[model samples]
Target: GFKIGGAEVSRKHAGFIVNTGHATARDVLDLIAHVKRVVKAKLGVELETEIRVIGDL
Candidate 1:
């Protein structure tokens, strides 16, 4: 069990993730992986990210 690299999944929304403080990219990645694992195990759903390229949506 790791410390999640200083990042955490948002309590207000399941689809959102947030930083604890001075977080690094590794923190966010770790938290995202954890969330995906939990969701897959508990809900039987596989999640993927649809990251925006930049300005356009």
Candidate 2:
């Protein structure tokens, strides 16, 4: 399985992210950030999150 700090992109669907146990909010956020950056750099497309992240990181 593929993962980063307990957060992983779903193998079945690329748009979903799964918590591989013991995952924190920071971990998921970091993973999302990484995916967005990579997609933007490689495809020249900016991804927008449907949910909002509140408070400080």
lDDT of 1 by residue, 14-56 (tens): 6777777876776776677787898899999999875533442
**RMSD versus native structure for model 1:** 5.0
Q: List the residue pairs that clash in candidate 1.
A: none
**For candidate 2, lDDT tens digit of each residue in 1-57?**
357898999999989999988888898898888999989999999999877899987
lDDT of 1: 0.72
Candidate 1: where is the Cα deviation over 4 Å? Answer: 1-3, 52-57
Candidate 1 lDDT at 55 equals 43
Judge candidate 2 at residue 14 and give its lDDT. Answer: 88
Estimate TM-scores for all models: 0.71, 0.88
TM-score quality measure for candidate 2 = 0.88
TM-score of candidate 1 against the unseen true structure: 0.71
Q: Pick the candidate with the highest TM-score.
A: 2
C-alpha RMSD for every candidate:
5.0, 1.3
